[model samples]
Target: MKKIILFPILLIISFYSIQNHATAVTKSREAYEKTGNVIWEIKTKEKLVAITFDDGPHPVFTPQILEILAKYNAKATFFVAGNKAERFPEVLRRVVKEGHEVGNHTYSHLITSKITAVKLKEELNRTDNIIQMITGTKPTLYRPVAGIYNDVIINTAIKNGKFVILWSWDQDPRDWRNPPANQITRYVTKGINPGDIIVLHDWHGSEFSQACQTVMALDDILSYLSSKGYKPVTVSEMLYRSKTNYPEPFYPFR
Candidate 1:
């Protein structure tokens, strides 16, 4: 009687936790919608999506992730910090050389919510210079560190000629926290839809093992996307292929 009672209780608790998580994600998407000039996800029915990796140019794990992406012929975007790119120029170059999109992730990965507009501009310029120095083309996309930004930050980025990018709310698996590989894979693969943007980290400066776990999840994610007849493209490509679906529904949960 105790075992049977506990099992049902555990199931109820698990379901409640998942519901809360989904609600939080929905709230975040609503907040993002209020912040104009950000592209969280495109709206389309063409079976295309974008994969983005942040804080990267890791010499070890980045190459591993790249290998996995190449295996599936999938294209992604890398939002690289200037300090890391400076340290791992070869890895950064390899990311661009292989046809992946590169974006500015700021100079030192400073959290945008706590920084001033001037400081943010300085960070963005420093990162753009580093990326241009290595890749020969300035990045047209910018994703602030920690996905924290306001209208001021967004306008600042626009003045610098960048379109601010954010990932799909449902697609985040918190890989930086070093969750299990299967959990990361399931979260992403399950939430996937046409025009969705999936964010994963390729380098965690202090959490070395976290990126390795992301690399482990990448193979499975790509395999599942391929099997489902989905095409993984760069964020730019997704935007280009997007339909003119205007004023998405208030909830927009899929």
Candidate 2:
């Protein structure tokens, strides 16, 4: 008799808990929808662009990219995968130490569609914690894995105080596929525009050699930006500049 009574009570508690969670998610989604939190690119008249790298802090390739950036005195944002960053905390620290910005790229590079809302939040929080513990700073920028996102993903990020960052559609060179260095350079140089966010990769799976191409292309890309009199800055820096330099949001959908 006690077990039967306890079972119904437990069921009631579970139902209420689920309902509360659903209500919270719904409220978050509706609230954020009123004022969008997604940023694709920024608009400005000045020759400034934010170049960002995803899936990085690779033990080998990351150092090479940093060296190239240092050579040009350019700053870029690195959206680091938490698992990789945890393994290479030193490399991540170097990225910040060298005056670059870091963003959260999820704990295990999880696909949004494949995970539950709770799981997604867990991933973001875990990555945030890992980054904070290692660098003493929690990332406020988040670029979802494979750039896949939805209402749940956006709301979850905003609830955690992260802005969903995406690159300009034309600025992606797909460097992870290991294209020729010159080709990658040409694609970036030709497509770059003021306030554009360029996306590149600094880490590729086990094959370290695959990421070398991006490092090679980065050297020339930076040189080209210099010749064009364009300044490369971090995403946060670009956003800050937009507030003062150009007061218009450059979202493509708008």
Local distance difference test, per candidate? 0.82, 0.83
- TM-score leader: 2
All candidates: TM-score: 0.80, 0.82
Deviation from truth (RMSD, Å), model 2: 6.0
User: Which segments of candidate 1 are over 4 A away from where they belong?
Assistant: 1-36, 205-211, 243-254
Residues 1-254, model 2: lDDT tens digits? 99999999999999977865563233343354345567788777889999999998898999999999999999999999989999999999999888889999999987545455688889998999999998888888899898776667777788887888888889999988988999999999997899999999988767355447898899999999999999998888888777743223222101
- List pairs with backbone clashes in candidate 2: none
Question: How good is model 1 by TM-score?
Answer: 0.80
